[model samples]
Target: MKAQGVVLATRYVLVTLIALLVILPFALMFMATFREHTDIIRRGPLALPQHFSVDNFRKVLFQHHFDRYYLNSILITVPVVGGSLVFALMSAFALSVMDFPLKRFFLLGVVSFGVMIPEVFIMIPLFQLMHGLGLVNNLLSVILPSLAMSACFSTLVIRSFFMGLPRELLDSAMVDGATFWEILWKIYTPLAIPAIVTSGALTAVWTWNTYITPLVLIHDPLKMPLPLGLALFQGQYVANVPLIMTGATLTALPPIVVYLLLQPRVVLGITQGALK
Candidate 1:
């Protein structure tokens, strides 16, 4: 018992140390946002600021138009999340519950091929396609690609959840003359809420933080989202550390809030999906 107790104590200490190591940089970044740029430069990033000020945040929001960038992020993220979830749920339902030719092949393609291909690999072709469609610098250029990627991954998640559902329930619904759409809406959707929420939250975070796609496709500064907007604070010669950190903090908050709100559902969905 004493040996086991020592092992447990050692494990706890190790985990706590690792956690602190991982979180320390983020904690420092948060603290740096409240410091003056000169103080940060003089004392270094780890030092405590002489005075905590919201001035950097004010400058980021007002002078840098972080609020407009924030709005653009919302406009992009909302549609991507919503559209992805809607499309993924339908695709998952078809793949999970219904019988069709090449169903397994399709599922395998989504699970394997869709994820294996990195978006960066196709950015050049995607840029050409978007330009051809006259969508260069358009928010839809970002939204459409994000939606497709999100839906592909989300389908795998939702399909796993749907497959775990009791077969009898779907059979009973079918006996009542429920069409596929009716069964999907009335039966599968309610039971799969946790998975849906998980997918939506994950998609929202991915879409919100997407920098490369927007940077490549969008040329208009006004149309730029938060991740791209954050770059505007950095100059060729001089970078405003405090203001940049302030923008980072703002840029990070929404996804953080969304994850917090949906954390319970995400945990439950992942746990149940794994068990089944």
Candidate 2:
């Protein structure tokens, strides 16, 4: 009993230490956002601020037009997440439930291999394609590619979840005159909410933080998303640490909120998928 108690104590201490390591950066950043630039320079990043103020946040949101950039982020993130999940769900359903010639080949050879290819390698070709399609410097350039790339892993995750589901349910539904679409929507979808939410949240976070794609494809200042916009905001406020940190904090909020809200579902979906 004493030995077991010591082991449990050690585990708790280790987990607490790791949790602090993960949280310290964000805690410091949040504190820094409230400090003035002069105070930050004088006191150092780790030092407590002499005074806290909301002026930095105001400057970032109003003076820098971070709100517009935020709107742009919503526009890009929403469509990419929705479109990718829709494509992924349908593709995963087909792969999980249906039998067709070359299905295994497509799943392994194409989808699996596609995930291994880095997005950086395809940027140039993608740029040319976007230009050819007259989508260069447009939001579609960013949104379309994000949707396509995100679908690769999203499909795999959802497919794993679908495969874990009882085959008898689908087979029984079909015998009762249910079409593929009806079975997918009426039966599979209702039960797969956790997996869908998990996939959507992950894709939303990725799309929200996407920087390079938008930086390369979009030129209009008004249309840049939060990630790219924050970079520009940082450049313009290089000496102003508080303002820069404020922008950083704001940029980090959406994904943090998303994960916090759906953390349970994400954990459940991943564990269930992995077990199957």
Candidate 3:
């Protein structure tokens, strides 16, 4: 009994230590946002500031045009997350529940081809396609391609969720003379919200932080999203550390806010679908 208690206590201590290590840097950054730049530099990131200043956030929001980038981020992330979720759910539903030839082949294709293909390898082709459409500096360039591209992991996850639904529920819907579209709308979609939220949360973060695609396709400074905007906070000799930290903190809020709102669904989805 004593031996088991010691082992459990040791495990708890290890987990706590690991969690603190993971959380400390973000905590330091959050604190630094309210501190003066000189204090941050003098203290070497570990010490507290002499006084709290909202000046960093104020300057970034007002003087540096961070608000526009924040808005741009929202415009890009919202559509991308919504479109990706819709596309993945619809495709996964058909792939998971329907009877068709090349069904296995298609699933294999999603798993194999989608995951293995590196974005770098296709960047040149993607840029050319964007240029041809005259979408180089447009938000549509980000939104449209995001909609069309398949996320294998999301498809796999939603497929698992769809597979877990009782076979009879779908059959009963069909027996009632419901069409596929009707059944999908009235039944499947409502039931799939939890899983969809999980997928949305994932897509939201990725689309928000997208740097390379925007860098290659976006030429206008005013149109750049938050990650690209961070570049402006850096200078040759003296980096704007406080302002950069402030930008990062502000940029991080939206996704975290979205996640908090949908956290229940995420938890429920994972718990319910864990076996799959």
Clash total of candidate 3:
0
Cα RMSD, each candidate: 2.6, 2.4, 3.0
lDDT of 3 by residue, 118-172 (tens): 5566778889999998999898887765545535546767787888899999999
- In lDDT terms, which candidate is top? 2
Question: Residue by residue across 1-276, what tens digits does model 2's lDDT show?
Answer: 999999999999999999999999999889998888777778788997667778888888988989889999999988998888888888999999999999989899988776567668788888889999999878899999888877876888888889999989998998999999998888988888877888888878878998888888888888899999999888877888778889999999889998889988767655764563
Candidate 1, residues 28-130, lDDT tens digits: the string is 8789889987887788888977777788888888888887898899999999998888898899999989999988898786654664577789899999999
- Candidate order by TM-score, decreasing, is 2, 1, 3
> Model 1, stretches more than 4 Å misplaced?
1-6, 42-44, 50-52, 264-276
Model 3 bad stretches (over 4 Å): 1-5, 42-44, 110-112, 150-153, 235-238, 260-276
Model 1 scores a C-alpha lDDT of 0.85
Highest TM-score against the true fold, candidate: 2
Q: What are the TM-scores, per candidate, against the unseen true structure?
A: 0.90, 0.90, 0.86
